[model samples]
Target chain A: MSTGNWLDARAGGARLSRRGVLVGGGLLVGGGLLLAGCGGRERPSIESRDVGSDRDRNKRRLREILDRQTEAVKNKDEKAYLADLDSSNSDLVEHERMVFANLRQFEFAEFGYNTRRVAAHGDYTFGPVFRITQLTADESPVGAAPAETFRYRLAPKDGRLVIAEITPASPGDQKDALLSGPPADEAWNMTPLRVVQAADNVWLVGDDSVPDLEKFAAAAAAEAAIVRRLWEGRARFPGDVMYLTRDDDNYRRWFSLGKSSNFLPEISGFQTSRTGVRQNGQVYSDQRAGAAILINLKNIRDYYSGEDPRVTMHHELAHSVTAQLRATPSIISDLGSPTWAVEGFATWATGVRWPSEASRYRSQLRNGLGSFKGLPSSKDFYGAKRSLNYLLGWSVFAYIAQIKGREAAVEFYAQVIPLNDTLEPFVELPIFDGICERTLGTSAGAFLEGWQRFVRRGAGA
Target chain B: MLMVAAIVGLLGALVAGVGAYLPTNRYQATATTVPCRRVVCIPVLKASAVIDALKAKGHPCEQERDHHWKCELMVGTLTFETTIEEVEGLISDVSVLVVRPPDEEPTEAVMDYLLWLAALPYTADEALTEEINDWVVDRIEADEDAEAEIGGYNYYVVTSNPGSIRLRVIGALR
Candidate 1:
């Protein structure tokens, strides 16, 4: 439902905070001693010892590298962070640097790695591989991505362990790219785009023939300004947008987060992670940072002319700004937020506002009013006609913003969208009634009736 | 130019003829079922059957007293619950609501079992037929009683086992 950073290019990092060092790094501190005793090289001990001890020594060496990252993040030192990474991978360094910058803005109170399991891919093309099934965590508003399992592939660089690759991992990525997986650089986009300045707030990444990239950037900058205007001195949204062209395979490899089918033109462009600007938490922390705007060039080129990347840019950026609220640390249970509210808020913020030009929702609401009930269940979000929920949701939120006031509506949303621990096959009627009563100071029926009246008026207008 | 055009036409015809005959549809599992005339029978995954699924192997399952089953399943951190719904002591429908994890593409056995559970009391309605296709990897069976196709996956397929008695089955994938 949100932007997926498949084979994400975002550069973000996380580590235990100063306090976390005393706790998480306590064991790692011992490993650090082992690492120092070995003098930055794991090979000598492996070669000198038996196979079992060699494996143990190798794992300890890998843990030392992770501990260094934890220490660096804890100390807020960019150099120490990069020291654990393969400096030979300049792009990776740059990416991690971007991640550090983004996370520093949040000033996390604490961070540490959790649930680490390592695998030895004895010999791979990138180098000897050691994969760790670990995730990063932090105590902050911007959170980390731990939705899926991730393995950090550590290959030998200068006789020491250095992170080789992580994102866009799949069964095929392992077989095809071996140790390096997908390039840490811009290998997915293949085309080297010249970054051209557009807006004071935007940078256009494109080459000739794709003049639309700048047009897309212009639209994004415009949307960002509109959001800033609506936000009106609320929390600032800082992450900028980046666009690139590539084949559909890369799109599938980079962004399809399971729920969606790639190569579908419906996805105009995507903003990776809920917050693409800050990296927090332990697992898949890098994915949440440096939230970049990636447009599916092939989808545009094939059809759609990339004319209005605005629709998608606005929708996704809407996510990037609100990403903080979706985190576990935040009060809102983002995963539990009704699809209508989660998506509709963005839709109304952009397309559904002001005069409602050629409103598909007007027609949909005309019919939906007949069967309008309570809030949409989780089933409605993933169901076949999910677009309907978006339209209906936009109408509902638009109605609320108009009646209840925009700022209050946004605030109310953050308040109402709390966690629902119930398992699947969900029905939102009871949940909707409770949320409406607490947030809107009315019952679900009253809320529906108010929305219906707005729909009718909007349809007439 | 005339000769070239003729050759192209001939090749196109040959390709089309081969395409028409070849079984383009590969159904990993299928079944034939007879419609229930009176008491509608439903089939839910026997907890044992769920464990049999290769990817779903080792996932712990608990069938509640109310006759609902839940599983905290995983294929590399892509965790989700596969819930089964029962009607009248028989498992009527099995649905995974939020969404299925992408990597763990539920096997044919799983889909077939789910479809069979859903297609019970086949009222010969189009809605049920559509539901079967939506969940069964986009495969559908319109026929009612006969051994229509080998890939009649996720249907109350009429098998070699006697009478108008319909049994749920997962067909072989070839």
Candidate 2:
């Protein structure tokens, strides 16, 4: 592998505008939930009794892991709760710390993980996913912010059953073993959060250095000001902007990524919320959602200079501020807007002054002259197709801000977000043209022409 | 004596020609580059562009789910496979592999031909792609050969300038 400079990964170190896909699994019994890929060594010859005994022992260990976690929450013992986790992965260890701290703030009459089905894969075992749950104060009922269905992969480490990986559950992953509640339950589990008040509306986590955090908070404030100023009436759910430091050991555990470069390494920053509905097994929804933004300090330093984490914060928080603007189930906001608009608006919010993004776009355009067939899809948002989609998307909204005042663009954005582009008979232009005419009262053709021209000149298209 | 010298020269040329043709019967290589160390920075992005150039050169590229991209290019017996890492919107680094089916140590003639394979990036043209398909045939029909000698050992070098991406390809026969 080529030893790229540190900056290579820093700029691309975060999630772009993407759909949330969680990976998790259920509790693993000592026996086998499903045996796979054993290469003839895996035999079904073992008697059911021995397998049952092994399964029982593993269940006991799993129960202890979860019970200890519950007791820790009850006693407010953050360290003890984290102690149940497999600390083999340092980042996960740190991430669990933040998760534990976050959940600690909430009142938990009951806190626990319930496993469903656990598979045995040779040395490792995982299947389905266990859920983390908590009760509201007074133990009335679990209402919202249920923890995302996190799967537990267990392996014996240091003489105890330990969690090897905690991934968000995907489709076809629902299994039956030790389920205790609906998979769609909402109860976000937060680890310990290092809190610092960056502003009245913003809080910085895990860092004592206030100057940079303050700058990021101030920048977020600026972006917030724009969001409020532009769409005060429509823009809802604002306050308590939690800025998670990128390199934070506890904070990094929030995301489970595969492969360092192709996808896992792209984590720059992200906006996750305790708000949003768990509709369709989705973790976060736009409706009635409040958010927390994780900021990669390195990404901020590389892209926006070390002076402010707000560089990426502005872009990420832009999503947070309007995160639930188009909650699911709404006729217009159901499908969500195109990646161009979703990310473009965020980029535009950052003031579109940075030359790096556009500069890279230009070179990208030079490499693939006719690559831009039309608007960027969500696939383009994350993939080897690279940042062309981001650049083109930004350019689109930048064009919008140029042609339609930024305020008008914001208004149009809020209005059209509910439009679905993924549905059948999807037509990018007619839909956009109609929306432009209705919301912004501009012709889409002229606007597209202008955007194309802008891309040509600026991106060397 | 004159007849013997002439025959010796002809035989030497035939042997070198055959040597170049033999290894390429099944040689292969793979190259991949990582673009990022943490996130996608300019350096990483730039390195991705180099991968982009490779893709642009018409090699088939495949992104493994959400990991790196693996691209394959086969030119005669020399097959080069390149892999590149991309994260979210970031590109990491590049790694390449050169492979061949069951082979002994590379002879000078074979290495000499491999230099052409290495110089494909420098050629900045698809002409080399076609050349790779018929390397042995071309080697046998060739009228020109490496003549540079340093420290009594002959070596072949191709200064490849691949679309403003500079890399050096050097080869020697033992």
Candidate 3:
């Protein structure tokens, strides 16, 4: 991509506008090129700092209202919190009530609201508003502080500015703030969330579309136990949240990859971490605070039918169990273990209940072992041979467990998958080899040879 | 003077020849404004503008359903199969199912192309349609599936399934 093209991507000009293309073409033909991409919102002019100005006075009032609301949240004062929201809009008031109730569940070290930019939209003052929060160990063990940014539309109800509406702030909002990193939409910010305690530790956070919350939660709890058993004495089982949405829009629109940038339809479930606010040298949060398992209810028809969601559920829960163990702090690039190990372990943790998976793997192995790659990497997870790669990944851990005992396999995982936030470039093969030699008393080359042999033997090749 | 007169006459002849190949005013009016042949003119709508648009864009279109034309076209560098549904002589909906290599993500150019195509039929002109396209894409990007009323036309971009995107533009007449 050219510098102009890169800028266009950043400016969201990649969303085609023929007029923009024509203009750009005209400019190029005229020998004066400009990189003003389509859909690029110009920064609103800074407001005058003059205290006497009506705009300034109103902004100050809005600031006070925001401050009061933030204090109410921190203080756990429901009345005060509800006071800041417009009373006429029963929906906003009701939503804010639920929001307040949700906020009480978390232990916040710091909580406040800061106004970055404000503009008058019709009868409402709309701007990008940010809610700064740092959760204590109750929510995040790492003391993750994230500034949730939202577009707040406030209007003067009676004599004060009250919040009329709240929507997730777009990437453009961050652009306006001159902030780095892509904006992510959390369920709380996107829609009215229903936070329910599924089990003693398992919290079910979903939207209204989630059907029979209690039933789903019970199933999720059962799966959580299976996940714990899978990682028994191997890794700590982190009691976390599970998200499910029957509403197709919510299912597709939540989290960072929403709006189909990299979203694949075939995905049934995945683990995602909601990170803290980006600051200093970090791309976003140095540590991820909130980790949740998002289940695609739209794809899984069996879930609605009350069929056992054990296989997929266990796979996702295993991820949460190993999340903290694998978290690498203070990094921009997603560099760590190869996908073979990460997903391989998860698939392996699916346990022996599903012998069909192993048989399937063996069948695939019998066919494709002729052209087996050394190991599947992170990129291979989405590749054409992903199924083969997934099975191969499972085969690695399964081989280790078979040869050296399950304890040895777990030990190998612990040694290989710990948090090592190194920026130095290194090949994964040697690292895996080194870890294998240290943990399993085998060379990386020997491991691969043995793994392939084991796979062939299992396949009767 | 005689040589200049000869040159002018030759230029006039060339202009006349080019004009002959261009779409006539009657064709444009009939295709867009007035119903041709029958009162409903559904066949004319399908045979002329909609098919012509696909053909002009180098897509091989065939009538798959009664009034539905399925065409293979290149949006950006990616080739996608599109089904355009004609309801009551108007292109009511267009669904683009992107065909990409496994593991490949949809490129911005492809997305832009899809949005532009969606906005094209309902828009009065290319320029205005482009503007609407930009807004619709941006709105959807900011929110979820976006719906907006622009220039008396209701434009919607649905991403319920990322693999296939459905674009529906309902005109005031509808």
Q: All predictions: root-mean-square deviation over Cα?
A: 24.7, 25.6, 19.4
What lDDT tens digits, residue by residue, belong to model 3 across residues A109-213? 567653432344443554545566554322444533456666666677787777777776555555653232335365665566676776767777767776566
Report lDDT (CA) for all predictions.
0.43, 0.45, 0.56
Tell me the fnat of candidate 2: 0.00
DockQ of candidate 2 relative to the true structure = 0.01
Report the alpha-carbon TM-score of model 2 versus the true structure: 0.44
Order the numbered candidates by TM-score, best leading: 3, 1, 2
Q: What's the lDDT of the predicted structure labeled candidate 1?
A: 0.43
Off by over 4 Å in 2: A1-102, A105-146, A150-193, A207-226, A240-243, A246-252, A257-267, A273-290, A326-336, A352-372, A423-430, A457-461, B1-174
Ranking by lDDT: 3, 2, 1
Worst 10 residues of 3 chain A by lDDT: A42-51
lDDT of 2: 0.45
Q: Write the per-residue lDDT of candidate 2 for residues A31-126, one digit (tens) a residue.
A: 122322323222222111122234445544665676788788778798897886777688778777766776665544345543322333443444
Better of 1 and 3 by DockQ: 3
Q: A39 in model 1: Cα distance from truth in Å?
A: 44
- Residue B169's C-alpha lDDT in candidate 3? 50
Best by lDDT: 3
Error of 3 at B79 (Å): 53
